[model samples]
Target: MLTPTGEIVAEARRLGVGAGAFNVITVEHAEAVVSGAEAAGCAVILQISENAVRFHHGRLAPIAAAARAVAELSTVAVGLHLDHVESDELFDQAAANGFGSAMYDASKLEYADNVAATACAVARGHAAGLWVESELGEVGGKDGAHKPGVRTNPAEAAAFVQSTGVDALAVAVGSSHAMTNRDARLDHELIELLHDAVSVPLVLHGSSGVPDDELRAAVRGGLVKINIGTALNIAFTGAIRAAIAQDVTVVDPRKYLRTARHDMAETVTKALRVLTGATP
Candidate 1:
């Protein structure tokens, strides 16, 4: 059923478990995420990125509404989250479009500017009764300004949350964004230190780059929210390729899409089991 992000995440914190926040770009992604969560008997967050909004020609309302409906109807608790939104207008759009929570990515800005902008977003999101998450420092492995060695400081992270009043904080703990391979090594020591220092929940971005064993360990080490994107993209693209190779004459969208969705669902389920330690 549809629930507040704070409620879902707070329960996770209490239970010593992390919630999977999968990025969604299509209807199939949404279906597979919900199905995976239900199958795992765990709550999940379905996220739509700023890039996704741009891909859909700026019409996020319909897409967000559909995701929200799926979350509302799911057997397990689910949250519709807007990810990496930089503008207040975008955050406003997401809040109005039925998103339960959102992350405003002001990491590209200067430290003070990022803090100010994120604070504004937090205020607006709280006013709308939506949970807000923000990134302090940068996660490496992406084309962004942050380099791989630039890790978030524990003291800085704690201060950022205290000043901004956000529900969660995404800190750089050694994982990079959009990594196709699972070779990134996380500083488990840093993760534990940050967890001890920060009162808010810790979010791990670019988790797709981390191996399955490391992911489970990160959660065990106190990371609360894991954001995965590239792995799902890999499953989706690989399934499409496999389906096309098997039937060269099949041109129907449903034929290949059905195969892709099934593959994606299995991938999600596998990730859920590893990260959340949930078993059927």
Candidate 2:
């Protein structure tokens, strides 16, 4: 069943649990997430990032359509979300395309500018009845704000949410993006402080780098929405690489793609268990 991201996040926050928001680069990724969610009997978010739109030649309609179709067909609850979107035009398209939620990323701008841009975005998203999310700090990856010590100030975070009226907030707290290794240490105490300071659900980006025990600990501290991307890419790419390497003569793409999708699904199920504190 297709579910609203706000509903899922709200439930998780209310129950003091974590909601998994897994990024999707292709249709298979979305399918695998839903499949894993069904196996775990949990609701999962399907996130499509701005980079993915660029990968598809700056077109979001096709990928958005594919995700919606997959979500509608799934037995488990699924929510479609646009992740790390910085363009107003693209953000507009999210609501036009029937996305239940979107994260308007203006964290790259100066503090005041980010708040101004994000506030306007929140108003626009709210007008379209979309649950809006904005990032306060750069969750360290790529360039700029990649420093390991950078973390979101609980006082500043509370002010940003208050000024922007965003439905949720993603704060930097030690994790960096695109980390293949899962050794990132999160500030558990800061997470608790931010949770107490902010009125809305807290989102943790760059969560792929956080270990399972840390993830469970983060949830216990106050993270409601957990964003994961690189881990799936790692799982998918690794499985495909191994399958192809083992059989040099195999030429069919489906043979290897099947293994990749299955492996990714397994990863999602395990992550869900950790976030929800279920016995794996």
Candidate 3:
């Protein structure tokens, strides 16, 4: 059931639906995501971030192989994606490492530099048959360079997409990254304008901070690909905390990890339902 990431995004765009992309740090996370997608009966993208690569001490082959295996065994359609890829070497390795799509993040660089770097990434990704995603302006960060106030201009976004030849563009509307609270307010009007203006599919990053109602509204406003990471980490960590606390005598790692995995799966299932408007 391995599907192309572009197919999922394009179909979602045509239907005005959200194509959920969940980040996976561990093989268990991949399994949980697949389980959740199957429960919701929808296709999903499993993302591996640059930060995650660093977490694994710069090793990607093992985890990437595991994710590919999980995707092959999945009942629901699944695709692998690379998120927030800052390094050229890492981005270049994505296709060979089993990723169907990748987001090249040059948002930290100067505008011209970002365009140049992202354009280069787009060409390489396209050559590898990978769906290329890039950000015009960052969606969120505590840093001054990419804060909550940053918003992508519709015209500029359109131009960027056209110039870079990217498959999709992540626009800054209102969401902030790593928000523990789901209270981010998105500009529905801007989202619609961006969608109409841009030639490619629109992406909403830092979606974990967005509320469910707003999420559905974003889809209605033409957000096709939604990147969600912090929410899964929140669920995974919260469950681990609860499980370990309930049984202090538990020495087995699997005992607590099992609880965490199940909770994360439930969270993913809910998110998929919200994005796809699936029945509970």
Please report how far candidate 3 places residue 112 from its true position, in Å. 1.5
RMSD of 3: 1.1
Clash tally, candidates in order: 0, 0, 0
Q: Which 10 residues in a row give candidate 2 its minimum summed lDDT?
A: 142-151
List clashing residue pairs in candidate 1: none
RMSD of 1: 1.2
Q: Identify the superior model by TM-score, candidate 1 or candidate 3.
A: 3
Q: Best to worst by lDDT, what's the order? A: 2, 3, 1
| Candidate No. with top lDDT | 2
TM-score of each: 0.97, 0.98, 0.97
Which residue pairs clash in candidate 3?
Answer: none
Relative to the true structure, how large is the alpha-carbon lDDT of every model?
Answer: 0.87, 0.91, 0.89
Candidate 2 lDDT over residue span 27-63, tens digit each: 8899889888889988899999998998989999999
Give candidate 2 regions above 4 Å deviation: 144-147
Model 3 whole-model lDDT (C-alpha atoms): 0.89
Query: Per-residue lDDT for 1-280 in model 3, tens only?
Result: 7888898888887877899999999988998999999988989999998888989999888888998899989898899998989899999999998889999999988888888999999999999989999998777763455766788999989888888899999999999878889989999999989988999998888899999999999999889899888899999999888988888898998998888889889999999899988877
